[model samples]
Target: MHSYFGFLCLVSYFLKSLPQVLCQRTHANVLTNETDAFINRVLADWNSPGGIAVAVVRKDDQGAWNVETKGYGAATANGDKVTENTLFGIGSNSKLFTILATGLLINNATLSPRLEWTSKMASILPTWGLWDTTAAKEATIIDVMSHRTGLPGHDFSYKWSDDVPRLIEKMKYQRPSAEFRDVFQYSNNMYSVLSYLPTVLLPSKIPFTRYVKQTIFDRLNMTSTTYSFSVARSTGLLADGMARQGINFSDNPFGGIPRALPFWATAGNEDGNLVSGGAGIISNAVDLAIWLQTLLSNGLRPGTNESVIPAEVTEKVSAGVSVQAGAAQFPELSPLVYGGGAQRGTYRGHEILERGGSIPGFNTQVARLPFDNLGVAVLTNDNDYGSFIIQVIKGRLLDEALGLDKIDWHSRFKALALTTPPRATPRPTNASLPWTDFITLTGTYDNPGYGKFELCLIAPKHPGASRSCAALASNAPTILPGAVEADIPTFLAEWDNPGFSHIRLTHFNGNVFNLSTLSSFPANDSSKPYWTHGGDSSFSSGAYAEAAAEGRHVGIGFTGIWGAGAGVPGPIGSTVRERAEVWFHKIPYDMDFHLE
Candidate 1:
């Protein structure tokens, strides 16, 4: 069976390499009944009600391209069905634009240093420094763009309100989880810093927004795709984002629970109000069709023989620069490698460059098969951890295109995705743990890298996370999912952080708390959370159980001088990204500090 499948893959590659014969099936044939059924069945099986826009572009005979675009499910509550042009935020897929925009500068370099992949960041920004002194001085444009920089994503540390320059200044303070180029650590902060490079590297000193607009957007004629939601909304074609009920944390299906989520907006403006360098772009299949073809042609403008994305730029962005996974995740694929903004690996013997991204309510995936001259993009207006459903869908699409044997991609991934691990045994709490234990530590604690937050004594009606969200925090019990009314002198970590209403901290032991420990409730409601907090996206709208289909949790511990001073070794941030636990010593006022 394995040899037969391999023979089919080889034949598919050979046939694709041959010049397209007009007698061959049209591109429309790519979306056969089999493909459609596969997509629908997986979506139904996973109980995903929100819609998705899928576009497939393939090189035909004579080097021309053929396309098939379609939409499935409702994009809005008014029952407006999703179509080829409905705009949905592509999330971190915007990183591709950042890399292509960098390619533009590289192609048109007139600077003294002549910025190339190897140009050291230190020369570009004197402020660019990191705890890894060697990496701080030696890291290059490619290092940051490829996420080979020592820093992990210290996502929560970013001030959504700060301008690019200030954000660049804050980069130095973010601790690094590994030495330079030791391992691949995905960092939005690293990508976020690249957004500012246009302003610094070129004589025009253009912000990323304006520079990419002049260079890439106009070149591709993507008028509908913009960093601004206002522009997308003006078309009256923006998709209303959705999430599964109780999915913010529960893995089980809630009857395909679909709830409308707000488009990412702030102070009555687009999500671009936050940051565009990392994750921020609203586009549809129409514009993305052009993008996929461009990638398929290695940056050419489809059949015109014109280069919209300089060929050199295209090559560098898609070429793998660092190892993401040291071992193959499956027998069919090669070890994963992150190119510039996306990932590259083989799938069932076909080479593929791909990436998956999501914000609070929207999830997206894009792929390029340079070897076969095929490309695909899927924009899903529903929340998912890694956009896995689309991942499964795309795999089957490839198999259908190649005429290979069907594999149960959905069931295999579903089992892996939905399998709930046994809950950890709870650490015994101090039997006499008193309210005084909470009150004593109820002050601002600070980290040089992560900054500061006030851990409050009350349930946020007093000493709120911020006065701005106080009313919301006070009413949080009614709004937040899995509402935890902690019985053992629980406290709330209140901060007026954008994208977050409040976080509930429950007592675990003497001085530690489980950030994510929760009590189950009937979370399958249509109404979205009044607020959100997440992995790397501080996108200030919609709901993200960001813990995802499973009740994912965060943990925090306060023990004998437990941070920098206490000699806790390693970086602080999500355990997924950090080398050690995040810690912050209590405020200076808490001298000799066991204030009970």
Candidate 2:
């Protein structure tokens, strides 16, 4: 009877410890096979023209990590293959590195404790002269990093310019989208300021790029990572950026399939020929794996007990600093929080930290599961469809690691993508409406929130062709295109950002028209918000009239979408519910409009 009871106890103990024993036997080979198969499946599902590179690092029971990289598609138009060493633009993933640099500065005691993370911008940059004295006085380093400054993205204002100082100066004109420290609004302009702040505060007068390299990159041994466009171009390992062909068409929500853009050989050129602290860091799967390992280990270099970033600093930066607004796409990940350029959320009851980046030609995502000591970084040249692939792969990997049921992320994403409706076809304009109507619409328009811009009527280069309008000039100079019109009677609307300068208006009725941009995608359904290729501007109404007496001849109301990424669904329903409406009023051509 005693022996039988002991045998029963032993059986129960073995069953209780079965999962742990199986997990211990999950070798590097098993992980590698699973990850490779998962990535291959994702590549096949996405069918992107350009290459994608992914690196997954998992910590073993002994505290060391097993790293693996899987590369798919061509790295360059010239047919160079992607490898672990192939460098691709990491986009906003640069933000995490920037935050680490700031943390390192604080850890080193180079910055005063009070000013390290919470000092007011006005106190630190008193001489720079911000237009909004109130924001300048109250916005802190922590506020900016955590995206709680109540500022809107204002992405259009400095999309093409490399002048950081001028961009900072222009922030004065941008109004807050929310109350101070009350809501979350992602702002790259704010991050640009954060990256440059250390340079201003540090006594050595070091440039942001140099300071980051000397402090963080050098310490982590990220030898191939670079902040300079010229250096990235010089390296043969740099991957060529690719965008889908026919991206301007509204019918093609998937960006019309990726094609290599050899002109975008270097990633840093998008920031106006300079290294952008916000979205400018070029690295590869191998180097990024090292970065992930460092992050997972709480800023400690693996194998060598050397601490690159202080553990306390890492803990503070990773902790929630601001509550993210609304529910995320995955309900399990609700109540998101932002801290030091990374977002923290719960995934199936496990802690997950992530950040993603989208530039003109590249898309990237980096995620870490600190509790599991696992990390993944995905870089792709195809901007439009890359996010979908990354999210799918990340989700699958996490599910496998956590011993959760495998979800069909590919099928789910495909269903969502298929549900997205193509842009609405514009109705034919009333040819009978006199040309005088268009003539009256030609003038300069001004918005206090934006700036002065001219709309001029341009005669078609060919006879018997439609007359189009040209955006001649703007208070913001880099966006000027010198009065060139489209082949049709297209009117180009100028947003604060230059990339959003291509909206076309087709007349639908008297003094009313249907508005669309080269990048506009139709709503997935009436329940979902319309997707724009640029992910910024959305036209609410395009109308004009001959109101010569009031100086308000033409008016356009547009709602700007703030934080939607490539392939990500924006807030659903009416634009009014999700974004702020910006109004532009046309003034006489001779009138000198001024912004308040």
Candidate 3:
């Protein structure tokens, strides 16, 4: 979903020599009736299917690029048509700005990537308080940009009125899923909190907005882009500011009360705050082009025409540090990629880096083909519709402009979609035992460090707080760590995420129950019970011990201790499953932890 926000490929060309043509085409104009035709075709498609807005930019003569904008639909259901300068919620696409701004500080030697923000900032802003000593203090600037921070996407409870002081206070509870940088975990919480570094370092009373504006936006001439949600809303720059897409946005925690805007601004955790790496930022496609063009030129700021960030820093930003091959509770963007919210791939045979953003009525995609000095920035007010528009634009403009092949498969699929009947795929079942036999295995389990946990046999309507647990029971087994309990079926059946080579399920009486790897159990009728290797262990037991000793597999075991460590619980001792529930209750770590 999100992690591959930039990796998701809408279409690709079959042209083999596109790179050669791309090098030659530089400094040439991509504008013509042909370019317009391609744009129109895509715009027409967007209009019929209903899209918000779209814009594309390609290198023109003298290293300049032409930007084309089209407004097809409204931002909200009852909103107005999009305009060329229409502002859309950029979502995580704003991370680029944050990263670039941070890079500026590093370039000027004002900030150290290795310095501990908690220590230095604590001295400057004592009210910020010390973060959890566990793994929180150890996180560095590099960790946040690289998505190595252990904090989850939305681990801290945020409120609308919370200011910087609240964000610092929230950090005291921000614990890591593992040691700092141990694994690539995409964390918006980390990104938001990391901004504090600059705020505390600058002059005593300088606000973050002014600092960013003076350093990044103003330097780059991004006049329309803004960080203040309230300003954007008041200025009419942001469309449907407090709405959501795909599903209705909720304010109530208990389901009935209307909730205020979650107001991510309060999280203060860098990774999840309104301006965190996950979301926040309001800008138009025109302004985004100026931003993307700077990145394509390797940190060259607009207007002033100065190098805002060093070339080395630019290289570091482009070169991905974290590899999220298969992370649960992470985004499942495509069959092969996963991450926070964006996906990356190639277009017209040229290497392309891109990210997509969507929140209720907003959808956007930002792509750059640095090799060809070509980039596309699309901002829309609709969510999924932009995905299709992206495909059309890529196929029509990029492919034809580069003399490549268009993606006809998407068109073919759309045409054939009306005739294709939905398929009924049975759930995976473990023949060794019926689901009823495993009912006793469900209950609260307690561990020392990690805290309390549970696995209850819930009715379909009674899905609880463990987001992943409900997804496991539902037919949609897309095992993203914090996905709604209803969507796990998508992942359970498909080997889409990176880690899974293939999927196999053993069912009792033809009813799918137990899931396993396809390669491990080649034959379905084998009589032996196909127990999960180390990582799949329900509790810390002999299997877990074996895995730990070998260090070959990741097991689903508890982190903290509960009862006596010497022996297994007898009549008075509780099983590991019960202990797991207790740990769930005690521990408060983010479920959506992964690297992008």
How well does model 3 score by local distance difference test? Answer: 0.46
Runs with alpha carbons beyond 4 Å of true place in candidate 1: 1-28, 247-252, 265-274, 421-424, 427-436, 459-473, 494-500, 517-580, 588-596
TM-score attained by model 1: 0.82
**TM-score, one value per model:** 0.82, 0.77, 0.56
What order do candidates take by lDDT, descending? 1, 2, 3
Candidate 1 RMSD computed on C-alpha atoms after optimal superposition onto the true structure: 7.5
lDDT of 1 at 144: 89
At residue 547, candidate 3 shows an lDDT of 7
The C-alpha lDDT values of all candidates are 0.66, 0.63, 0.46
Instruction: Identify the candidate with maximal lDDT.
Output: 1
Q: Give the per-residue lDDT digits (tens) of candidate 1, residues 309-418.
A: 87878888888888887778778888888878899998889899988878766888888888877888888875653277777877777776665787887777887777
Which residue pairs does candidate 1 place in steric collision? 20-61, 248-545, 249-550, 250-549, 251-549, 465-494, 465-495
> lDDT tens digits, residues 157-209, model 3?
33334444565566554433445555555555455655555666654535555
The segments of candidate 2 whose C-alpha lies over 4 angstroms from its true place after superposition are 1-27, 30-35, 108-114, 127-134, 247-258, 262-275, 425-437, 440-488, 493-558, 561-596
